[model samples]
Target: MAVEFMHPDGLLQQSDYAPVAVGTGSRLMLLAGQAGVTPDFKPAAPDLAGQVHAALRNIIIGVRGAGGDVGDLARLTFYIVDWVPEKWDEVLAGIARAQQAEGLPAPTPPITIIGVQALFTPDFVVEIEATAVLD
Candidate 1:
């Protein structure tokens, strides 16, 4: 618990997540956008569902390598190539699958999703940028 989540009284706060996060850790980690790639930098899956899961898993790997877990994450940004509102369902399903596979806590950090024309490569369908603070 290195962050304080704030959802002020009258700020259109109907969403399940906090709009602001105030962190207290001394060390801050700004992770680069993690793509849905495998160990050898290969695409983990062919579809959005599998790519989303792989991307989240990669975020977890990055955070853990920096001595923190998912709880230490203060924010997450998702960049999806050719994203659409209807694709949100697939995103949710992927996250659920990742949680089951990686045992990641549902941190519910403040988030932003962006639709991009493309990522670093065509193989990666999604990339996730994570911000975390640690002791």
Candidate 2:
């Protein structure tokens, strides 16, 4: 699969994230928002970094279950409770850890992050939803 990123004249260019992504593939899979929760609906980890990694793992499971790999992901959306600019460090750290553990490549998809006051419950801090494609 081939994915392209376009940066217009005025829009800012980010190294890891792009404002837009164009991809062509044979199949597309949309995954529901996944959080860091155990089957019994308990938090997988107490800290934000751990939660982020857990959520990333969930994302990989979802995509792979759908017959796709990390390279097939087209886009990602993240929701963070009580989000702050400083929290990006933790998020990046978690992503790095996940990439190392899972042997996943750099995130090539366009990603959007949103901040909210709460999620399904107070214990849940981060959730990720994704769209994936396979050629």
Candidate 3:
């Protein structure tokens, strides 16, 4: 498996994702956005940290269902309702727990966390998306 860093003439390398991700001879999986919302579309937890944890759990389930484990994950994007420097540690710890459950090694996937005003539901604190590449 291979991941290439690509940059075009007019794009900012750090902030912009590649226009296309090419993975030759490797299986690719695109997962849907997973939030803290339960099966009935209710928030699992009103608190930000709890919601983040729930969303990560949902992501793991989705990955397993797709025949790919967390170790196969190459990139993850997180969208949060409100982000502050004080919350970084909580976010990192949550991610570490998720990675550990999947038996992934250290130096986790490239992650992008974005802060937004709100999500589809007022109670939803975080939403996460994942991309996996399996050998």
Candidate 4:
């Protein structure tokens, strides 16, 4: 599969992501917003970093279950409650750890992060949704 990123003139060039991503593939996968929760509906981790790791793990699980690999992911949408800009370092670190554990490639998908007041529950801090493609 081939993915292309384009930034039109007059638009700010984002180093982390492109304004548009054009992907060529035969199949598309849209995953639900996965929270950092266990099968028993309990918080998977007590802190933000841990929760982020757990959520990333869930994303890998979902993608693989759909017969897609982490590299197939084309986009990511993250909804965070009471988000702090400084927390990104920890969040990214957690993601890195999860990817390493799962033997997944370093994620380079276009991502959108939204800061919200709350989620489905008080214990939930972050929710991650994904879009993937498969040939």
lDDT per model vs. reference = 0.84, 0.80, 0.70, 0.79
Identify the candidate with maximal TM-score: 1
TM-score of each: 0.88, 0.86, 0.73, 0.82
Candidate structures ordered by TM-score, highest first: 1, 2, 4, 3
TM-score-superior candidate, 1 or 2: 1
- Model 4: how far is 128 from its true place, Å? 0.3
- In Å, residue 27's CA in model 3 sits off its true spot by 1.7
lDDT of 4 by residue, 1-135 (tens): 444556778887765455666778788888999998897889999888788778877988998898877777788888989987988887776677776786544445777889999999999999999888877
Pairs that collide, model 4: none
lDDT of 1 by residue, 1-135 (tens): 577777878775745456888889889999999988899999999999898889889998998899888777889899999989999888887777787898654546787899999999888889999899887
lDDT of 2 by residue, 1-135 (tens): 445556667887766566776778878788999997776778889988888888888888888888787777778898999999999989887777777886445644677889999999999999989888777
| lDDT for position 99 in model 2 | 79
- For model 4, the superposed segments whose C-alpha errors exceed 4 Å read 1-21
State, as a TM-score between 0 and 1, how close model 1 is to the true structure: 0.88
Question: Per-residue lDDT for 1-135 in model 3, tens only?
Answer: 444334467765543234334344278887887997788989987777667677878877887787766666667788987787688777766666655664443455566889999888788878999887766
Ordered list by lDDT, greatest first: 1, 2, 4, 3
Judged by whole-model lDDT over C-alpha atoms, candidate 3 comes out at 0.70
Per-prediction CA RMSD (Å): 1.8, 2.1, 5.2, 2.7
Task: Tell me how many residue pairs clash in candidate 1.
Answer: 0
